[model samples]
Target chain A: MSTYDPNVAPKVSNKPIIWSLFAAGGTVTALLTPVLVLLFALAVPLGILPAEMFSYARMESLLASPLIRLVVFGILFLSLWHTAHRMRITVHDFGLRSDGAAVFVFYGLAAIATIVLAVALI
Target chain B: MSTKTSILPVVGSHHRTLEVEVLRYDPDKDDKPYYQTYQVPCEEEWVILDVINYIKDNLDRTLSYRWSCHMAVCGSCGMMVNGEPTLTCASFVRDMPAKIRVEPLENFPVARDLIVDMDSFVEKLSSVKPYIIAADERTVEDGTFTQLPAQLADYMSYTHCINCLLCYAACPQVNLNEGFVGPAALALAHRYNLDSRDKGRSVREDVVASNAGIWECSFVGACSEVCPKHVDPAAAIQQIKIAATGDYFINFLMPWKKSKNTDEASSGGGK
Candidate 1:
């Protein structure tokens, strides 16, 4: 009680890094995921495009390039990270206080999935 | 030759009796706070504050609260009207239902009936050093500094915070974290930090950039909605997040540039 200075500031935390990634992931998912969904899921089935517009052969041709493979992987990685961070925040908002456990579990899943996807792509 | 128009109730034409339920507590008398109802004869054009005054005058003298400057400028009449933080002076009695529930602002200790203890709020306000801190003190002989209208416009809107604390009540982050500097204070901090004449961004950054500061805010945006003055503390906090992120990267890549300046905020350089 004697030495408590409320104004005495602590060192800046490392949350900026996490927040930056979360923000980037949020933007990437928001801008690209809807288009990806519309093209890959709804467009062909709803008769907006032909049935064989996104055939396995066409998919193979598109993924033939390493650059396109890297771009797809990058989007998937960011979207996964975004979902991981969102889940953690949503859990906290739902009145659960186990932030440490949530971070470990959520971010651990994202990291494990990223590695698995990377190896499969290889 | 006065041409002012009066909106007072003519005779008994526009009189409505309202059952106002107010949360009451007496520290010396009661162990816990409870509701006390007042049957108030509300006028046609009376705001919520006028209804409280009517109760105080005609119904209950013991009902205590804070008010001054009958306008919203005083910011003393902030309370929860139907679970929303409201400036009673600005909210019309006609807008509410027949039954009104009034309570002290949330996230603060109740001092008395409809009055909250503002000690913690005052402490938080001062922690940000809400003032222009220049590199050197200038005497009267130094004359006045000139600021362009464009520069003034940058931080003009933020200067309108009346310390009503509606933002504090509306924000869930404040309710959860006592250490986190609430909206009004952080908005004020940003107000000063944006001042071109100020040079103490580094001094303020120790507290402002901490975990309990703007980083604690998750951009729920409740503060912006509840702000009566439209000061937009949420926006201020988010802007600070961007600047702090820049500072974080700058500090990481070049530790020598740790001392941040107000003028060179790396904040896109304009309003």
Candidate 2:
């Protein structure tokens, strides 16, 4: 019996919506992550950068600018989404087949974090 | 047959006897497949296919496998040569370790020994509608479909998929997701979709743009790596993903401004 049916469709997936975010997030993470790591983790910790360069008031001052806030928001937003997607794939790679749960949990956290970040920015 | 003219780069100088462990299964008899080792006196120029051929001809008459056209063209001789999915014809025996292990291509049901059941593969292939879809059928009198060299180049590499299933064997997505439309089929779909003469891209999008189609592919790029013909199926899938994303936004934003070139294709396409 012929089992192949191209016309047969299951529930239409909204994966593209999420995948677009994932891809954009990946690009942002790849580009900005290393520089951010060097500045935050290496230079700041090593005292190569003056501690005040990354101190709370300096960060607040940077965030006070609308443009700076948006750029920082964009970075955090994309990076969070990217990390969530990577977590999903990593979970699957580790032989956990429960994609539904992973998506719900990881993307759920990402959504919450993004909302929190957005509200904090405002 | 010594010193035969060949297009393959000459590799391995001297001959040696190799221990080849070929996976064997007889569905009518055995419950599970098992390795049956053979001491193959492999020639320096011989590939893994030749080793298997020697085993079939001399060592074990019961050995079953599929292969034709020993020069990588037929694409039927794909197997796990030392745990790596490869075209046995292109992989020299000299390149394999002394203790070689050969098995059916991974992520497939074994029909026999090295011949995996291709029923699902065939079904998926048919689902994609591999041939060019021209709304206006061209007769012999109308002459051949003329394509620009650029248009040809757009999809020429993908046309090289002989359905060897090596990409499938290598792809983790294919193994994890059974519903995935897979690399080779999606690449072939892209081939037709890119063809200037083919107007069926909109129609094909029903299957190509589905979640199981391009979205299921995480762009592991293993498909591109294992491809004998240098077909970058991963890139093709990524290209489709970008198009599908655009389609998603376009459909939501300005639903009226829909055209095949600059705009809409259904994201409902799937496996």
Model 1: per-residue lDDT, tens digit, B1-271? 7454765445445568888999999999999999998888887778999999988988889999999988889899999999999999999988989999999999999999999999988987888889888768989998887787878888899999999999999998778766678789889999988887777666777777787788778889999998889999999999888887877888889887776453475322533
Q: What docking tier does model 1 reach?
A: acceptable
Q: Report how far off residue B16 is in candidate 1 (Å).
A: 0.9
A1-122: candidate 2 lDDT, tens digit per residue? 01224568532345777788889999988888799899989998998998888889888888899999898889899889988998998888777988889989999999999999999885
TM-score computed on alpha carbons, candidate 2: 0.87
* Residue lDDT tens for model 1, A41-82: 899888999978788999899998999889888888888888
Worst window of 10 by summed lDDT in candidate 2 chain B: B262-271
Per-prediction TM-score: 0.91, 0.87
Every model: Cα RMSD to truth: 3.9, 5.1
Candidate 2, superposed: residue stretches over 4 Å from native: A1-7, A10-12, A41-55, B1-14, B135-144, B257-271
**Pick by TM-score: which candidate is best?**
1
- Any residue pairs clashing in model 1, and if so which? none
In model 1, which regions exceed 4 Å deviation?
A1-8, B1-13, B260-263, B266-271
| TM-score of predicted structure 1, chain A | 0.87
Per-residue lDDT tens digits for candidate 2, residues B1-271, read 5686976755654488999888999999999999888898877788889889989899899989899999989999999887789999999876778999999999999999999987777777777788877756789999877766766776688799899999999999878876787898888988877766766665666677766677777778999999999889999889878876776676668767544433223212211
lDDT of 1: 0.84
Number of clashing pairs per prediction, in order: 0, 2
